[model samples]
Target chain A: MKNEIKIFSPATVANVACGFDVLGFCLDTIGDEMVIRKTEENGIKITKIEGYDLPFEAEKNVAGVSALAMYNALQPDCGFEIEIYKKIKPGSGIGSSSASAAGSVFGMNELLGKPLNNTELTNFAMKGEALASKCEHADNLAPAIFGGFTLVKSACPLKVLELPTPPDLFATLIHPQIEVKTSESRAILPKEIPLENAITQWANVGSLVHGLHTSDYNLIKESLTDVVIEPYRKQLIPHFDDVKSAVLEAGALGCAISGSGPSIFALSKSEATAKAVQLSMQNAYSKSNIQFETYVSKINTQGIKTL
Target chain B: MKNEIKIFSPATVANVACGFDVLGFCLDTIGDEMVIRKTEENGIKITKIEGYDLPFEAEKNVAGVSALAMYNALQPDCGFEIEIYKKIKPGSGIGSSSASAAGSVFGMNELLGKPLNNTELTNFAMKGEALASKCEHADNLAPAIFGGFTLVKSACPLKVLELPTPPDLFATLIHPQIEVKTSESRAILPKEIPLENAITQWANVGSLVHGLHTSDYNLIKESLTDVVIEPYRKQLIPHFDDVKSAVLEAGALGCAISGSGPSIFALSKSEATAKAVQLSMQNAYSKSNIQFETYVSKINTQGIKTL
Candidate 1:
């Protein structure tokens, strides 16, 4: 076919604080690049893999799975070769797998003259993630593919909403030297919840959405408390409480686990607070001799792009 | 007292199904009217009471207590004579007490030449509720004072947000003869909730808020389910399950107990569904041989109006 299409997908913060499987937002720091080429062949195949050591098998790799799903659905006659350059670290709280998955669908859709809309791309990308993670979750993929803070309402009807992120939200994320296996983390969470706490969590979640829409900083702060996952998950992260306290004491609005564990994100109003949060994380980690890399960046309103 | 002001306070729905103590909305169906006049005396006095044979003592009766709080706060160098024209039933589960409290504040605020903002009025109204219920909550008063769907973020600092109501939404409310006291209803809820259920509720609540803001009908329908409160509270309402089933079967978008309810509310897309819901409630209530009154109407967006 000899058709070439290039696309970029941003790194994403999945399970944003309290929003376990429902909320995600794009990150500007790291991402993946995928280049799709159509050739005169029977089916799709993976031509190249760069940046990280991901699978070369087109059906097993995240990017490959996503691209293959799209190809199968669209039933493109031309054979396509996908080249994925995965920059984000796989198995990190930052959506590495989702980026690759999103990148594959994004590139393939572009290569096929944009047959699939964002929703369709998100579904195809989620199917790709399911292939890798053994579960279908699209919070990360949707935002990475579509941009902005996104909510995945359902997987069946595939309802996705791109929420407007607050303007002055400077996020400070610290990924400690611990690697939390996604499978292990997923196992620890309980399936059933007591009725009352569930009600409160939803109230805060509703408030959080409203805060984003209205730009109400105080509401955002109030809604950021994760009474569900963080309470149980924080035990895995060293100095989680100390780091959270330091960030809040240093003028950060709220702090919580990023996705599952190891990575913690704090929000601040100004550059000073952002810098302070970065320092606070370093300080908290220093006492425990736990080294961590921190990112002090603004909200990534723009998700993925053609680069 | 000859020179004072009269104000109208709208009916409010507290413990708004999925959002207990956090969400409330005002309605135009039932309300209370209060007249406050400055007299030569040194303290507030309730000269007249109508609708319900409530206590007339200024510090004890909800209307009288609300007026007393406002009078004490303002310290206006005059005693006030209050007349309450209460329309909301005493045990209607439709924010009956809140209407009395809010009416007093609205009336007193008007008499005081609108000295307080809506937030301040809500505070005084909540104080009145505290005197009546022994609990200081803002859910009902906030909406009654502010109008529309409201979220009370912090009761201490007093933050309230009026959320966008879903469009083309009609409601059918059926009030049976049974009475479920708020205090008793609250006691039944479990204090601690499971983490998983909390996450699900938050996800749904987040989606609900988005649905309201965006006016997405399907999202609203999906978000309206209460896994936390409705199941437990339904036991207190006679024929609750049948009423809910009938309403849903008759084409209600959703149905739930209205507040700590013997009163149930069902939402529908059109007036036809609203009427159908009313008939369904009647059919369900027929089993108990308890005659019920049903109101088929759209959301009373124009909350309180001067007659």
Candidate 2:
């Protein structure tokens, strides 16, 4: 079937709260769309963008790499004409790069009669992420491919599981007008952590996992606190802790830095709490009087889909 | 109220195979007893064992310290005559010391009209373990206090939860006749793990907790793997890999070191599989000219109770 397959890939919050390097959840706020059509060309060629500018080169671009990886897995000779519409910004830290990669793989696989399982597709998408980040970390790729709250159990062989996300789970994303490079933020983390801090991190990670599975909002709030990474990364975001505090005071379940960011995610149990959280975020940045965008979204259960 | 109280504290597997610092489970096979009398001495006193040359001094003996800690917490100026009857072997790596400490707290708390919560009594029991090992680790104390499979959510504040045990779950313990000093075993573990390994550990920890809460047997088996700790500790246990192979080959779901020890545990789905596992362990050790004692046990639900 050499037909057009249009797919949607949701934005994701990687390094979800306490689960650094292992957890993420899809966001319903924004996503990217990719249309893959079988073409006569020898390789994947990304055609056009509906919004922002992204590389269209076959080998250099993330979407192109993602399509190539999938094609190589099944039929290396199959050519794909991929058109990507980037709704999420390229450097936005809300899994910007993953959306393109996920959309490409998802659309291409659908067009090709669906040969790969979600895990296999995740592996292909992860390769695309690896091409851009120079490392195969599955934190972003899992949620983008499988949706819901996801955990990348292993990055090497790519074991991604869709965990049971809490019902009434709402997320508020506040992206301040600032650029924080993912590479730079990652490099800033200390190469070695004190043994005491490592133990504490693992304990919190355990608790967070428990909270997520049990839907214990209070435990999740307690578990979201990062004593090791966020302290260092918050220096990059103006009014970071203030924003967190304000949202929490406004009845957020928990709040923490959303990836390597000028953005932060606050969890709330209800739409009203989410609205209050949105206002709190605006007020926190009002001191700097900086313009910021806020998104009140239900946790995205349908990750990447054909649109 | 002056009364005779008989309390039974179950022996526990501290390290819980995969979860080195964060998990443990109580077992019914072995334990100790402490009989506390409301004496008018106005201070805590330890009466030594009938046969063995165990410590009798208040600060030096584990049971005495536990009783004293409870007294200090509750009455602050009361007398306790604690008699120790240690049944769990001294260096079994099956939380023998924890049994004594927990038994002391259980006996005295009953005698003191239960003035403390389980958490509070656990805190008191931990003081005894601290005095015994000179290290403040809670793997043993958690299960001994709470029973079933337990998770140590926090160390500083001592948060412990009793996780549900699956009905089909069975464990086969193989205590090889060898002595590996707890301190030496502890020293062999690496101080730092790759961030990747740490993340995988947490993912499994989450799955394990979920498995317990939902009674998912396969999930429990899947979660019972150690990528961070067991690989390093294998050196201390002779024929470790071979024993694990034997256990698994005999249809055991999972197997690993029981604690900081010369003992190992294999979990299975049925009594037959458990018996097969026992034979497998015995066969593996016998091939290496080593003797081992094996016990098959279901998860203990009642932690410390009057026997």
Best by TM-score: 1
DockQ of predicted model 1: 0.56
Model 1: how far residue B81 lies from native, Å = 2.3
Alpha-carbon error at A196 in model 1, in Å?
4.6
Residue B247, candidate 1: alpha-carbon lDDT: 89
In candidate 1, what are the lDDT values of residues B1-307, reduced to their tens digit?
2277776777677655556667777776667887777788788788999887988888888877877787788898777788888877777777888888888777666666778988888888887889767887888788787877887766777878789977687878888977678788888877766555565566677787787898887777787777777767888887888888898899888888787887888778888878987898888888787867888766766555444
Candidate 1 residue runs with Cα over 4 Å from true position: A191-196, A270-276, A286-288, B249-251, B269-276, B283-288, B301-307
Which residue pairs does candidate 2 place in steric collision? B6-B306, B7-B306, B8-B305
Residues A1-307, model 2: lDDT tens digits = 6479877788889877777888788998678877888886767887887788767786888888877887876875568888878888777778888888778888877877888888888878877887777887778888888889886766766666668888987999898878888888888887655445555666677677777777888778778877767878899888998998899899998888887777799888888899899999988888896777888888888888776
Q: Chain B TM-score per candidate, please.
A: 0.93, 0.94
Roughly what TM-score does model 2 have, to 2 decimal places? 0.90
CAPRI rating of model 2: acceptable
**Candidate 2: how close is chain B to the reference, as a TM-score?**
0.94
